[model samples]
Target: MATEERNHVSNGEGDREEQEDEKMEQFFALLRSFREARDKRKHELRLRDHEEDINKKMKKSKASKLGNDERSSWVPRFEWEDFTSEFEFPRPLVVFPTPYNKKEDQKNQEDDDGLDLNLTLSSASL
Candidate 1:
């Protein structure tokens, strides 16, 4: 009877050891899965950050290019003359926005023609 009891005790200990080993394996598997998920999320965030930075740089680069183009498209020039030999109540000298732009010159030409007709009619009446 004593020997049988010892055998049963040894078998129970072996079963406990196997249960502990299975528990440890399950814990390790769960930890590994968590680590993989964390790594994947970190990688995705990094990619998103890189993409956002690239987009921002592209926008700034394009905006700067557009600004440069617009600035180069037109440059203004001004002329000044001393106020001498002037006898008109309203100034008769015409001022233009810029002499280098032909489109503006044509637009102003129509206005000037109409204004000249009105001025001639007015001065003739006076």
Candidate 2:
């Protein structure tokens, strides 16, 4: 009887170990699958972003080319020598007379040399 009991216990332990092995394998497979799905999603997002950037750049380049063509036609050519030959610039007319301050002139002349005024008259008839 004891021998049969011992055999039964060993069989149960073996069955438990097999079940644990299957659980561990299932856990590892789920982890690998989740990581793969996350990486694929990130890759898809990056590709879409790059595609959008390329489209924006293409649009800007096309607009710049069209603008350049339109701007070149509107530019005016300047011939300065032809205008100067036909039109003569006259001198501007003087509106106000040049300011003449007698006080400042006298002050400048007094600073030049010795100049004295003699204003004395003899008392003839009072």
Q: Rate the local accuracy (lDDT) of all candidates.
A: 0.84, 0.85
| RMSD score of candidate 2 (Å) | 16.7
Candidate with best lDDT: 2
Question: Which portions of model 2 miss their true places by more than 4 Å?
Answer: 69-126
lDDT of 1 by residue, 18-103 (tens): 99999999999999999999999999999999999999999999989887766666566654543455556675677776548888
The segments of candidate 1 whose C-alpha lies over 4 angstroms from its true place after superposition are 69-126
At residue 96, what lDDT does model 2 achieve?
97
Q: In candidate 1, where is summed lDDT lowest over 10 consecutive residues? A: 115-124
Error of 1 at 21 (Å): 0.9
Per-residue lDDT tens digits of candidate 2, residues 6-68?
Answer: 999999999999999999999999999999999999999999999999999999899898777
TM-score of 2: 0.50
Residue 91 CA displacement from its true place in model 1, Å: 26
